[model samples]
Structure formats: structure tokens, C-alpha cells
Target: MADPTPAEVQSYIEAGLPCQSLSVEGDGRHFFATIVSAEFEGLTRIKRHQRVYAALGERMREQIHALSMKTLTPAEHGATQ
Candidate 1:
């Protein structure tokens, strides 16, 4: 199977997770995403990653391989900006 594009990855996450803002950049095999969501509030880093993985679901195992993410709550994201 052909590797998925960054846009495709972005959509995959969006389809499953509710994000305040999200962006993805990748070269098929690996991806980096900055995801901001209210759902991340009070969650630990690992839990935040788990949530994103849950959002990706089967695709995380099937299509995308390596994903490096900056998961943030709206407040955290805003502070970073």
C-alpha cells in the first residue's frame, strides 16, 4: 500500500478527534502533528498521546507508522502561542 499523505493523516485525526487546531507534516512514513484540543485538559503526556492514537484507531497500525505529536489543551496551546 502507498503511504498516506500529511493531509490524509490530518483528516484521519480530525475524523476521530475534536481539535481546536491541528496541523500535520510528514513524508509518508513519519509524521509530526501539533494538535490542540479541550479534551487534553488535565491529561498527562502519555494519556494525551493515547487519545491521539485512539483517534487514529486502526489507521495508526495500518497506514501511519511513526507519529510525533505535540498534544495540547486549548489553554496550553494559547499559552504557547
Candidate 2:
């Protein structure tokens, strides 16, 4: 299969997980995601990453090779503003 586009990856995550806001950028094999959601509240960094990985499911191993993410709750995302 051809590598997935950033949009495809973004849509996949959005479909599987609940997000308040999300943006993804990448060059097929590697991706960077800035994800904001209520689901991230009170979770540790590792847990937050795990949640994203869970959202990706088998594609994380089978298709996507590398993913770097910034996961945050809405409040956290707001604080940066």
C-alpha cells in the first residue's frame, strides 16, 4: 500500500478518538500531531501518548513508522494562548 497522507492519518485518529481540536503534519512515514481533547485531562504524558496509540490501533505498527505527538486537554491548549 502507498503511504498514508497526513489528512488520512488525521481523519483516522479523529474517527477513533474524541478531540476538541487536532492538526497533523507529516511526510507519509513520519508524522507530528498536535491533539487537544477532553480525554487528555489529568492523564500523564505516557498515558496521553498511549491513548493516541490506542486510537491508531494496528496502523501504528503496520503502516505508520514514526509519530511524534503533542497531546493536551482543552484547558492546557487554552493556557498556551
Alpha-carbon RMSD, candidate 1:
0.7
TM-score of 2: 0.97
- Strongest candidate by TM-score: 2
Supply candidate 1's per-residue lDDT for 46.
100
Off by over 4 Å in 2: none
What is the C-alpha lDDT profile of model 1 across 1-81, one tens digit per residue?
889999999999999999999999999989999999999989999999999999999888899989999999999888887
Model 1 has an lDDT value of: 0.95
lDDT of 2 by residue, 1-81 (tens): 789999999998998899999999999999999999899888999999999999999999988999999999999999998
Q: Tell how far residue 51 is off in model 2, in angstroms.
A: 0.5
Give all TM-scores, in the order shown: 0.96, 0.97
| Global lDDT of model 2 | 0.95
Q: Residue 73: error of model 2 in Å?
A: 0.4
